[model samples]
Target: MQLASFSGFIKTLFYIIAFYYIFRFLAKLFLPLIVKKVVEKAGENMYQQQQRQQQSSWQKNQNDDTVIYNTDNVKKPRETKKVGDYVDYEEID
Candidate 1:
C-alpha cells in the first residue's frame, strides 16, 4: 500500500510538471500576439485622434477667414544688408 501511494505521488508530480510546461509554452505562443494586438489598437487610436484634429482644424479654418496669418498686410521689417557675418578660421596642425 505504501508503494502504491509513492507511485501515485510520483504520477501526480509528473502531471504537475507537465502542466507547468504546457502553460509556459502557451504563454510564450500567445504573449506576442497579445502585445501585437495592443500596439495595433494604440496605433489605430492615435491615427483616429490625428484625423479628428486635422478635420477640426480644417473646419475651423473654413468658418473663419482670419484663421491663418495674412502675409499681405504684415510687411517684414526692413534690415540693412551686412557682408561677412562669419569669420573663416584656419586650424593649424
Candidate 2:
C-alpha cells in the first residue's frame, strides 16, 4: 500500500512538470503570433482613423465659403511724404 501511494505521488508530480513544460513551449510558439496580429490590427485602426480625419477635414474645407489668397508676394503701400518735421534746437546752460 505504501509503495502504491509513492508511485501515485510520483506520477502526479511527473504530470505536473510535463504540463508546465508543455505550456511554456506552447506560449513560446504562439505568443509572437498573437502579438503580431495585435500590432497589425492596431496599425490598421490608426490608418483608418487618419484617413477619416483627412476626409472630414477635406469635407469641411469644401463646405466653407471663405477664399484664402496667398499674400507672400504682395507689396505693402509706400508712404507718400514724411509726416513729422525736423526741429533744430540748442541746449542752453
Candidate 3:
C-alpha cells in the first residue's frame, strides 16, 4: 500500500509537470500569431479613420463652395429678457 501511494504521488507530479510545460509551450507558440492579428486589426481601423477624415474634408470643401453668405445674411443673437420682468415671487406661510 505504501508503494502504491508513492507511485500515485509520482504519477500526479509527472502530470503536473507535463501540463505546465504543455501550457507554456502553447502560449509561446500561439501568442505571436494572436498579437499579429491584433496589430493587423489596428492598422485596418487606422486606415478606416483616415478615409473618414478625407471624406469629411472633401464634403466640407464642397459645401464651402456652395454657400454664399455675408453680414446681412447672418442672424444676430436675440436679446434675453430680464429675470425681474419674467418672474415674480410672493412669500408663502
Best by lDDT: 2
Which of the predicted structures, 1 or 3, would earn the higher lDDT when compared with the native? 1
lDDT of 2: 0.94
- Whichever of 1 and 2 has more lDDT, that candidate is 2
lDDT of 2 by residue, 24-79 (tens): 99999999999999999999999999999999988988999988678988999977
TM-score of 2: 0.62
List lDDT for all candidates, in order: 0.92, 0.94, 0.90
Tens digits of per-residue lDDT, candidate 3, 1-93, equal 345588898999999999999999999999999999999999999999999999998888787857555679678999987666556789999
RMSD (Å) of each candidate, 1 decimal? 8.1, 14.5, 8.3
Q: What value of lDDT does candidate 3 attain over all alpha carbons?
A: 0.90
lDDT of 3 at 5: 83
Which pairs clash (backbone N, Cα, C closer than 3 Å) in model 2?
none
TM-score of 3: 0.55
Best by TM-score: 2
Worst 10 residues of 3 by lDDT: 65-74
Cα TM-score of candidate 1: 0.56
